[model samples]
Target chain A: MAEIIAASHGLVVTQAKDISQSSLALEADVVVIGSGAGGAVAAYELAKAGKSVIVLEAGPYVPSSEFTEDFSQAIVQLYEDKGTQTNADGDLMVLQGRCVGGSTVVNGCVAFRTPDYILDDWQKQYGLTNLTVDALEPYFARVEANLGIHVNPEHEINRNSAVLREGAKKLGISWKPFQRNIRECALTGHCLSGCATDRKQSMLVTYLPWATAHGARIYADTKVTQILAENGKATGVLAEVTDPKTGVKKADVSVKAKLVVLAAGAVQTPLLLQKSKLANSSGQVGKNFACHPSTFVVGQYEEDIHPWRGAMLGIYVDEWAHPSKGGYILEGGGAGAVELSAVTQPGLGEDFMDYMANLKKLAGIVTLIHDHNVGEISWDDDKKKIDYRVAEADYPAMKAAIASAVKLHFASGAKKVYLPTVVHAVVENPAEADAKVAAIELGLQSLRMVSYHPQGTCRMGSDAATSVCTPYGETHDVKNLFITDASLFPTSIIVNPQVTVYTLASYIADYIVQN
Target chain B: MTQNKNKAASDVSAALAPLSRRSVLKTGLWAVAGVSALAAGGFALLRPSPRDSLPVPAGLVHLEAQHYHLFSRLTEILLPTDGTALLPAAQVPVVNHIDGLLDALDPAIRQQLLTGLALFDNAAVVTHFKRFVDLPDADALAYVGDWVNSGVMPKRALGFVVTKLTHTGYWMDSQTWPMVEFDGPVSRRWGIPSRGNQPLPG
Candidate 1:
């Protein structure tokens, strides 16, 4: 059992004095503010290296039993803002996990190493040295082993995902079976709705437990309010223990530490730094935010294909990754029945009904784009809200991605296709979508998009002027302060970021150990 | 003395004759009616007024009404009848649950729902269908179904409501299970491995 430290009158007061207060109260060598993929990796490594480590997680410790198959309850419990809507243009929906495991808990467990091309781009464009595919191979291998990453090719593919694969095959698109972290997944198609079967090896189950066993203490439901600093040297952090039910704010409890690691993710990390007045030199703390906006495509088939029976995402088509006539990757996306029903349109009532009339014959896929627009996150001091705005230039890229998805749907033998465009939306048949595609060879403008992966708020680089942190994830001005989450990602890679985050956290942990 | 004799004679006859199915059905109907009336009275006392409900705006009223119409149409299509005596989607208890959600919304939202309803039941369409509201429920539902399936209605409305309704309705309905079908434990047990091939004796 860990020591329970309570707060009284905005100071750390020991609830139990007979337990050797001084020894238990001593500051740790390293204090990490999150127990996510990044923080867990750092804590595990630092503790294993014989350094006293303390991890503060803002969310409750949800055991595997608490991993619900119910998507609505899971969203309410684990997601930030209760899966609230962000008005990026017009109510662009965004979902991010806010539990101890972070987004890793709620993500599709598709594991992919950072693409070689992205690494090459990082090296060439951002002056990032020693970031080649070969250099990061060992780190990737370590992460994979720890997380038990493997490709389950023998697992039965659900009809929805199978339709996507069949469509790609028919179109002669280059596709590959995705690698997931599950050993024996039955693929009930509730990946996004939290894994009740424990097949998904999220950081919460894998790394956090290991770290705790190695003497890393975790304080759950404790929100770190600010990073305490004095004379330009890091000291510790002040946090508040919040009431999860009422969300009542309280005074902060100051924790003294030799080093501070910020793994509060893209949005919260910058917000925390800004609130603490630690972002003085690097005004770029909350700038350069990016997320890969996604769109959905529903296909009406001619067979009884139960879409909810297979892996949420079992295949990927990389044909559109490079800049062609349009630049974007149209991949498979999955959701449970409730979510699917919610996203389907009311105007498509007839279409939906007609399709449901032949309910067994419907298959759906989602197209996710790797966006390159520079969005920003700003804090409302009075409201205590994070405001996000995406750059207008990136809208075209998202529109292009939607168009490409529709085209692929038609090519892959979808009888009908639905695009989220206002003008030429909801094609009655695949031929209609194809006709529209042919008409607009130059591509259509004025399209709406939704984002799933929000990243790169507090970026890391060599220079302090352009970036917030260094390659070692330390703020250039502050000696002992570091960031270990997606906030440190300088650029958005064209892949799911959970694996990269875990690997990079390991790498940063190694650096902290050496230093 | 005559009344007593008649009563005794009737009792003897009743005991001798077989119990009629009509009498049994009449007794059951009266019991069911009593229960239904009790439930209805309780619901009436509990139900809040539209103004006191969750603040759905007037603009949304038409939209909400249209949503109801669309929902009915889609439900029918999704669960079309076979020769068997399955419940029609319109008559399903789930429809009442959906109606309760609309009742919870603000009155303005309920008003906006009318705008959506007008798209299907406009003056022009009404001439063809002879007053959309006046038509039989089945006919009205069939009309909406024909329009939606044929892609005659504007795509804007389709984009606006279809996805939203599906998600909202599914989330609200506690009894509605996720569309996924799987074979596993009957009781709620988390973190258990898939027992795919193993079968327990019934």
Candidate 2:
């Protein structure tokens, strides 16, 4: 076997360059098609259960020693489509990590349990009676304990998060620190660029390694093109081992397994099924897509904030997070020069230069809405197209979010607050905030919309005709074919999705083991 | 007098009707030449100028010389070498950075960006009476602002793409980090060790 970095303990890892042959075949009891939050957990559990497992990842294996903490290099190396994937309208930038750990490596590391109300909705509306919070508690607790997910102590809250805390205090909005899957966050503020310090418990440093320790073999730079099936049962997968830089096909890889697990995230999971032309009898494979679409507002302060000095994300405001109250939460964090520049406005030249000069004085607040499931993913020719438009009904919540941030910034002694509008609306005082936000029009290119959490493209429900997957994440039309990613979420969880993904994967692993 | 004028007109018409074959052939050739000239002029108006002067930068993998020139001019206009900026935009090698990025992008996306650049550059002829690279600094900035604030979504999107690339290219350089007081990548500075798939800190 052409393995890089000698196989130790029971793990074997093979990179693209190691394979010199034109065709390679393997056999395993279970084959996982991704190595992210979901796939890693499932692989680890199954490997520990003595099932021979093989994991195939489409991205290159990047260790922490190679992390540069440079957004430019990181974008090309770690992000999907080199950070250029956008919605069909070309307005919203869809940011997802394409590396071995998937988005868990580049995420802000915020962790949240599946809220009780969301579970209740799933049970009552979608007949997902088995997905109750009580049923999921054990899995959540186990993953949390293993990953060291905890609330940030007072010392970890930096000046940027302190800005949000102060604003919420002045405005009487409920705010608190959220749990993050980090152990000893070195305060580097480079979470979006893949933590070089190995403080963030990303799957690369956690479950993936654990799975490898338990004898799960992983193949990097392998792209699965088709799912193999026979007699209404999953048999294996057909993939190509490709060079990471030029995408030149190096070898063909085939794996035969008794069970196949599809965990390639929301967008790619459904697209894979569509390309394979399997498990689509319900016609609901790529429908009901919901992403917690988000945008951040910048507030300019008089003193230097140095927002990029500490943790990437910290405090969160949840006063208006309930459905009745518009269903959105504001998180406090800071960004690097590149990220800030992507959202900064006011034309170009001197005006933009002047804005960049205040990079040290700027504090940011991000608002994430529990957007409705009104999107579809389909293939146009050979290209993947995501047609997602924010529902017009969600306009009120978006406006309220902007106005609230404006008030918070003004209350926190801000000289000016910039709205996250394409037109670059600014409010100097709280009195003008409401009008400025009210006049903001929702257009295709009106806001800097971004989605890090894409879910529900292949939803799970009780009925065979309405949903693509059963409540246990098995396709209704195909047997022994399971999905364990955000694609299986029946509804948007309205929070960072890594924790819930791990929980679901663990829960599904138990079912798979039992059966 | 009216009768004489009518006789003169009739005589002239008869002379014209009996024209030689050589004259008719000349007229037809002139008409074809005129139509060809018009088509050439329209094509010239649509196409941007060729890469005439700038030598190709060494080791550029994806971008053509003309694409390189367009982005070089665009980066200067977007991020000038003015006193406000820490380093001159010209000194940062933004186009090279962009070229590296283009090499990493999908071929389809790379094609779209190159097309968008040409369209944006040649479009300046309508408003500024010059190509984007030939316009004065002020006019170039004004043209970019026009597109950014335009009601059309495609124009605005184009503007967004160019400006985003410019900003990313500019700020990603370590030399520009001091402008914002960002201590670049503190792992080495703080002597943080690589854990290498080890257990988490208790």
Candidate 3:
């Protein structure tokens, strides 16, 4: 523990109280902004390759040690805007982490290898001819092998997911255990709160520590406001260490690097680039954004489901997740009291209390549907603003997905299922599902969709016409400036993207090293 | 983007008693949020009002006395006042709990809460003879129900935010833990108490 702390602590540059008085300047071989999956892997690989790497993170340095069961505090710490960052229309909310490990810290540790179909689509449609399924096999293999990605054992499945499996079985739907990057999970059901057990294999306990050990420097609570450029080439970054808790700019700092990596996720990467006025020759720095927006439906049974007592998400029913025409993936979900209280259907005084009172009897399944509508990210009032509107074309699939969730819950022995899409109306009889759901319009005001996974925006492609970055994640306009996060995907991966991100980052790191 | 996650993570349990580190962090975050909101307002003044369409006060920090009262009363109605078995739902000062929760909420949500509550009666302002505060209890309940059921945005939006907040406040009430069957203390339940580096009061 002492060694871990010493190694990790020595490499981070936190903002002091008065560092904002003057700019602190430093130099590095590689400067990676945003220390989550991409930045951490890039930092580890670069540092191991004997390059001086400085990774700037816009959130605080929260170790696995700091992860607690306290629901609200975790939201305050790990989540950006307490997990309520909404789209431009303020309809669909986004859940992204603003901590050291990034969204990986707050996610359910679902390590889906980038599906072969996605790679093929990216190659055939997005002009990334080199990103063939076979070409990327080694990268995927390395990431999964390094992270110990595996399907959870049968004994590890808790009631929440067990019900999902049973429901899928009863309905004759294809279901499988979700592959996760974890070792010895205590199943405390606190994955969304930054896994406390250090068993989740989040970047905080894995590549980040390895990077720090290999001489990588991490600047926590530091916001790289601009990707400083000269002669249309990457130079460095102008940054500030903003207070994570209060959202205050605490210090001014600058980094000069030979190469720069912008792995600041989908929303922020484009905003940062726009602020820098770099890498937008394609005019796609913040366009073509896509994600799997999810709508949740919960069920209450006569027996105790103990929704918060198991792996937050385990089994997934992906029978409906087709490549095109919009489909949704159904997965078991758990929420601590705070999250449940917030996102659950709003009810009258007594009605709200009754629902919460019977929380243990409820099990929820979130339907994640691949969206076709493209959104944009822009800087509005100096804050990264996401403007996403669910396209009308995608509504049918979304509704279908929600209907499936309702059916599954009832099939799983739910006494009364509460459909969030139908304004939390109780679904007692199967007959009421279609009528109530069909009555609800599929828009921001009615559907209330959300996404933990947002992709595209600062996309990668062979052509500069439609993408901000190259096929290997290098920005088309700026030499040595690269984006290697989910932002690099020309389209949404349509699954939990942590492992996909890790794999891509590994490939990017190898690319940087080889070059 | 680097936020002080420890300060944010200071509180685990939502109990208002004893003024724990969580409360201190909440106060600190509120102060910071207040400062930022003011700065944002100032920035807004320097630029064109970025959200001119928004029906919110310029830089609302704390709730006005009447507004606070209205919010408190509405929260009581929306949440359970009658305590449940193994959980003293009645004994909890729910209004006070809602006030605390507001103090800790994101500035955006806070703005939404304030605007949603204030401009909630745009329709009423034009035609109705009574303000929300002036209405009787039954009328107020009906008014809230309309807001919840209304297809009109601000009303429905306000209803949604308040409902969520009300639910959160109720569950966070230490007395409500038994009903949800959760052991309230976070450190014990989750195993690690590493959030021990809570800041001293600012």
Interface root-mean-square deviation, each candidate:
23.5, 24.8, 10.6
**Candidate 1's residue-wise lDDT over B50-123, tens digit each?**
22333332332223543454454445444444443332344343333344334322244334443333333332
**Counted clashes in each candidate structure:** 41, 0, 13
Q: At residue A143, what lDDT does model 1 achieve?
A: 82
Q: Which stretches of candidate 2 lie over 4 Å from their true place?
A: A1-12, B1-59, B64-69, B198-202
Q: What are the lDDT scores of the predictions, listed in order?
A: 0.57, 0.78, 0.69
Worst ten in a row by lDDT for model 2 chain A? A2-11
Docking class of 1: incorrect
Q: For residues B61-163, what per-residue lDDT tens digits would candidate 3 score against the true structure?
A: 3565445545555665666546655344446544455555555555554654554455443233332344554456667666777766666543455555555
> Regarding lDDT, does 2 or 3 come out ahead?
2
The complex in candidate 3 yields a DockQ of: 0.15
Worst 10 residues of 3 chain A by lDDT: A2-11
lDDT of 2 at A279: 93
- Give per-model TM-scores: 0.73, 0.90, 0.86
Model 2 clash number: 0
